[model samples]
Target: MNFWNRALIIILSLCFLLPVFAADKPNILILGEDAAGDSVPRSSRVFKRVLDALINQMHDKGFDVYDEAVLTLLENNSSHIRRTDSEIIEVARASKRPPIDVVVIFQIYASTQNLEFNTRINTLLMGRLLNVKTGKHLGNFEIDSGKNFTGPAQCQQECILTIVGDKSRILANDLGAVLAEKLVWMNNGDVSEPSKNNKMVTEYALIFDGFNAKEYMAIEEYLVIFSGYTRHRPIEIRHTRSEIWYQSSIGTAKLDRNLNKMLAELDMQSIINFEGNTFTVKRITFRNKEIKENNEVW
Candidate 1:
């Protein structure tokens, strides 16, 4: 009777702790940058508005989002913005700033054409998400809007400005929805936030080979699905072949073995071998038999 009572107490305690553990929301950083390669402030303004809209959307979806401007000011004591992926990730890794799980890079640009009686303007927004720990690009998205104003030439410029702002907000909301879905997928799966003792975790170097384009894509799909389970980054990738090198926290040999089993279950012929802190993968086939035969004739 005492053992049964103790077991019940442990179960109840875990049930209570689980919710608290899951409530630790992931931090996301949104960085806006110039893309026009000019002094024009249009790109900056559009990006700012889009960032604001994305933040609101993420907040509603229960995410903790930070703006680049605020982060820079707080960490660097300046309001300067970083424009590239490396720069953005560098900021996230700084000890002074709050830990970030994901980084969203956003850029906007516009083009205009003047006509005999009207004007046409097109604006585009491009965004991509990166894992802060692995430096892996999870996904990318783009949205564009075009408008034509056939009016008393004077008001044409005003119309274009209004359209730019409106479309920027719409694009931002759509992008946010897509990002939210990705986060939902991660949260529902084995992917967890970076460990607090990540630095203390041992490091491993891994190699994956024998993958063709089709098989590589298959592996990437699995990575995207199981990305939450491990924080690993590819150090080198051979685009024309089936090989990649990655660095990751140690003790992932079991994870790699599980992946090999999962691939075999999917009928992909691959084998993974692990040593102290290094592993290798070799695939039996480059592609499906039918696809290979069809390609051989070409």
Candidate 2:
């Protein structure tokens, strides 16, 4: 399904189910930048309350999560508050490990509008989750707290924090948890939090593996799931079989044929397995005893 359609389904699904525990460690890249000035003092730290509450809640539900404040760590008055979006993104990536499953980018908007007698001011919070490597936009959400939170009227950082809390709980209770779980599933499947580093196991199997925090990130880019085969076979239970059709370049042919040619010497059996949005070898299969020349996942 398209991202939006999937997001709609997820949101609807969550609206359908009660909140529950998430099964894995989660690395969250929180992007919070100054939205207005005289920008709220310590607003970055206050902004973190939203992330922390969500993380802590998910942690209670069983998830490993982390976050940071980019502009707050530096001087407040300096132009760091006005950093480019890419600069903010770089800072967000700094808080994460190499293979980030989810990147939660946030924005804080402080503004004023004309109202009866006095003006109405507010702080708006907006955020979205993106897949790090693919740069694909997964989902976005926003909320505006009606209270005027201008310089003097504001209760310092507390008012903003309260707004963040409201938004986060709403999102987490709905879109957040489901998407997070699906993302976590993609990050690592039935792989257990090892009592021992599975390095020996992965190396022997030739799948690259590493631990990020308490969880392991493993890659068997070559091991296409044959669907029917077991690494071992049984007399009656055994049926069907498959192989990891290898290719020189991991890049798929979806982008271009030149990519197909330049990545590796012409080989017939290797085919595009992990093309576009797919994760495992299950997406490809043999047909008429002849599926195509070659290809599979990244």
Candidate 3:
């Protein structure tokens, strides 16, 4: 074979292997909780041990776990700001190297009971998953260490470690499965296929500025027929301004195009803007209507 022929073969082989090697995987951030139900401090040895075990187990299951040290540094730098769960998610979302897809917060509960001459230590782990973009709860899972350890009081930490070592695999597997399913739902299934009606939906805010009641009504009629539109709730209504929250399965780009077409058909001039999930239609002008006929005309 000529040199060019060998190069072509290598290129084709790489094309086939690239997708297999670079397939999208959800980035996960795992957090621990203290007995008080607040986030466990990173300095806690128990937290470190549990986190390390869970991270290793999750890695073995083909998950990309976020580095806890980086998260801690982010939190420290933003110490002046309130560190609510939502805020932590926001910080992680903004500062994460690639980006955090899911955040899982788990709390371990330990109890002791006297069994004959020995003390029995029982541990249970409860986890809640949250989507970073939406900051909404995905699901929850509870894993109990079935085996109890009987030993001296000083052996509590050792027993807990044993429980974590044995149950980390189960916890990781359960979380990995759920995370995969949720990510698929969030992405609305395969990109090559049309989004289904039953797929996950996101709520968005639509604000209309400088629109009279009649023009607003016309827009509503168009929305009823808009593809992927589910429903809408009016937040405020006025001739000068109106706000509404709507749910849709389609993305913003399609919605923007549909709105632009509707405006053109209605003979209304407007500027459409999007910020995150919120959409704004501003500087509306009715080209064929009398401005004086509408109340509170802009």
Per candidate, the number of residue pairs that clash is 1, 14, 0
Candidate 3 has its poorest 10 consecutive residues by lDDT at: 16-25
Regions of model 2 farther than 4 Å from truth? 1-26, 35-45, 57-61, 69-80, 92-98, 112-119, 146-298
Best by TM-score: 1
| Candidate number with the higher lDDT (1 or 3) | 3
Per-residue lDDT tens digits for candidate 3, residues 174-288, read 5545544544555454222222445655557888998755577778899878988765555566546777767678888898899899999988788999997778998555544
TM-score of 1: 0.49
- The full ranking of all candidates by TM-score, starting with the best, is 1, 3, 2
lDDT at 61, model 2 = 38
| lDDT of each residue in 190-251, candidate 2, tens digit only | 32332133221110011111111111111122123322211211111101212222222223
Q: Which candidate number maximizes lDDT?
A: 3
Q: Which of 2 and 3 is the better model by TM-score?
A: 3
Error of 1 at 274 (Å): 47
- Model 3 pairs whose backbones collide: none
